[model samples]
Target: MFAGHDPYLVALSVIVAILGGYTGFGLAARIRGTPGLARRLLLAGAAGFLAVGIWTMHFVGMLAAPIPPAAAYLVLPTIISFLICALVVGISLFFVSIGDPSRQRVIASALLLGAGIVSMHYVGVHAVSGPFHIVHRPGMILLSSLIAVLSAYGGLRIYLARQGGLRLVLSAVAFGIAVSGMHYTAMHGMTFSTMPLDMVPMSDGLVASAQVLSLVVALLCFVIAAGFLLFLVPEPRPRPLAGFPGGFYPASEAPGPVSEGLQTASRSDRSVMTTAPLGGIGQPRQLPVQRIPVEAADGTRLVDVTEIRAIRADAHYTMVHDGQRERMCSWSISEAETKLDPAVFIRVHRSHIVSLPHVAFLRKEGDGAIVELDGPQPTIVPVSRAKIAEIRARLGLTKTVPPRH
Candidate 1:
């Protein structure tokens, strides 16, 4: 007849499972900010869960009563254990990905719980060490499932708390402590080999306590490790200066071909002859400062500066200034100057090459016109008027605009 199981190894596996689970969850949460990246992490975490579960089961099983040698059967049970654990973890991750739990963070915890059960059952089997059978009793299975669920729920809750604005460090510490307790409780229920009632060594309690303590420490370490993994994934920060080359410059700052070629010229040619006329065709002359002339949409007077007090680019004919008024006007800028300063910004509409700073909102209009300058500005800048559908796509907006007539 097959003997009973060992309690010490059961507890140890529980602790390990929790740690592995939490680590996976934290990883998924950190990268969730990216759209598809979190799903990949979840799937990968499921595989990891299976591996850890198998390893823990093997080791824990050996720790039980010494198993009689049956090498062939050993590998089979291990495979079976790993598959069961993997299925649980994979299913859990599927729910997590679908539910959108903080970048599929729930995957980790689920894996931990599932693997813990696999490890415990196999470890118990190892203690028996015989061609034994485990009659799958409903009560034992139910109890094991409950333990896994509790551990998984705890792990997931800790991660969610971080996303919900809880202090991450504190939450991790709390989670680790909780995992330790849950795993220890799970270990208490194992029914192992019954040698003689009084024959068990006194040192068994010391060994058992040490194992449980080790499990707790492992869990604590896992929590810290998971926390660090979450931090490892990088998030996009605001570019210091919104424009390129790390500084803000107008669209006219782009260099001209002549100037570019001159810079590329080698050596002594760098110095220009002062004898060259102050301004000439072959000489480097101070090109006229092409003023980006600003105008009022109401067709006001042409002036050096915008009278609307805050006029900013809104494509070719559109602009916004003084918080709400929209101006649409025809304007010109020297092509040479624009080529030099490509950073000037992109034109959003025929009337709207809005300065990045001035644009407050972007919305789609019903008539194939993407409505820019969304605030109180009375003028609904028509984007469809220009071939600006590409801009809409870049902004991740649907083509809500009607087809141009």
Candidate 2:
């Protein structure tokens, strides 16, 4: 029979689980912000810790109970439990990697992670010593699974939403409770026992809580060390790839040998030393916005950057607004913003970036401001309430608008 009641261990496990889950989420969130090899190593180490922590926490809960003749786990299945936790951590972090994950994708990833957690719990359950048939109450099992999924979803949501301070801690606590609750609930739902006379005594191979702790600590240390080594390894600097034209180029116009300074600029960017009368073999590279080259719908024609006015996020790529024409470029708004000169182009909204020089007038309508540009064809851009001050400063509007109620 399994260990009966162990509230103290369960409570302790819950606390540990929450802290581990939260720590993983926090570290995973920081992964992208960290540059180069450090980010990759840190992400792996963080994922490993979260996984191992959850696995060990379950065993800790197991240790809380005292079964007849003492309870021990089979070695192989116990090891597998740790792997399941790591899988869950890896999957959760992967979902967070997407800049803007869809709701369905996020929920699905969380549900899958929870399922792995559930699997880990059962695997540990099976690791119990002795040949015993285990039966689970269907209703209880489903309820526990639901709890795991919901808990995982909540934690993922908080991490993706970038919740801070009290909220984040609360989310961690909630996740921990879910982990503990699932373990105890599953433990109670199952009935496992062997015939007294036929039951085999536990052997040296059986896992103890101490063994689990040592294993987890060792794996955590390994992960951290691997990450540190990765951090030490310098990442290769990105070299400028072939210039983008999406077509055959004349021999004279073919890409020249790339220089060190030009390596940072995208190959797709159309850069010239200068378009001025003095433009020749060696002049400073053109401004970022001026360097952008656009391929026409026919692909045979290329448009200069001066023709472009504004850019907006459209599906996966950005829509280049050039007078009456619109061209789709395979670049995200954020990516495009980095290449453009900040003084000329400003990201006015999440999806919208506009050329400041194109602005003819700013009209105030209630709480919102609309920018109408002066050109052969006028384009109206809506400014969000959050960007009001930024718009004012950029547009050089000395008058301060009253705050909205």
- List TM-scores for all candidates, in order: 0.38, 0.54
User: Which 10 successive residues of model 2 have the least lDDT summed?
Assistant: 270-279
What tens digits encode model 1's per-residue C-alpha lDDT throughout 1-405?
A: 114446675555444544454455444443322236654775666445433533453344344433333311244454455555555655654555343344345656565555555464544343332333333445655565565556566555565534222434444444344444433333444433435435543321112232453363455445444644664565542223332233422222223443333323332232222112334437653432224333332334333222222233321222323334323233322222232122333344322334333344566566555444434433334454233454444455555778898
Once fitted onto the true fold, the runs of candidate 2 whose alpha carbons sit more than 4 angstroms away are: 1-4, 131-133, 163-167, 199-405
Judged by whole-model lDDT over C-alpha atoms, candidate 2 comes out at 0.64
- Whole-model Cα lDDT of every candidate shown, in order: 0.41, 0.64
- Report how far off residue 11 is in candidate 1 (Å): 9.2
Error of 1 at 260 (Å): 38
* Model 1 residue 397 lDDT score: 57
Q: Please name the candidate that would achieve the greatest TM-score relative to the true structure.
A: 2
Q: After superposition, how far is residue 269 of candidate 1 from its true place, in Å?
A: 43
Candidate 2 positional error at 133, Å: 4.5
Model 1 residue runs over 4 Å out of place are: 1-19, 46-73, 99-128, 131-144, 164-187, 192-405
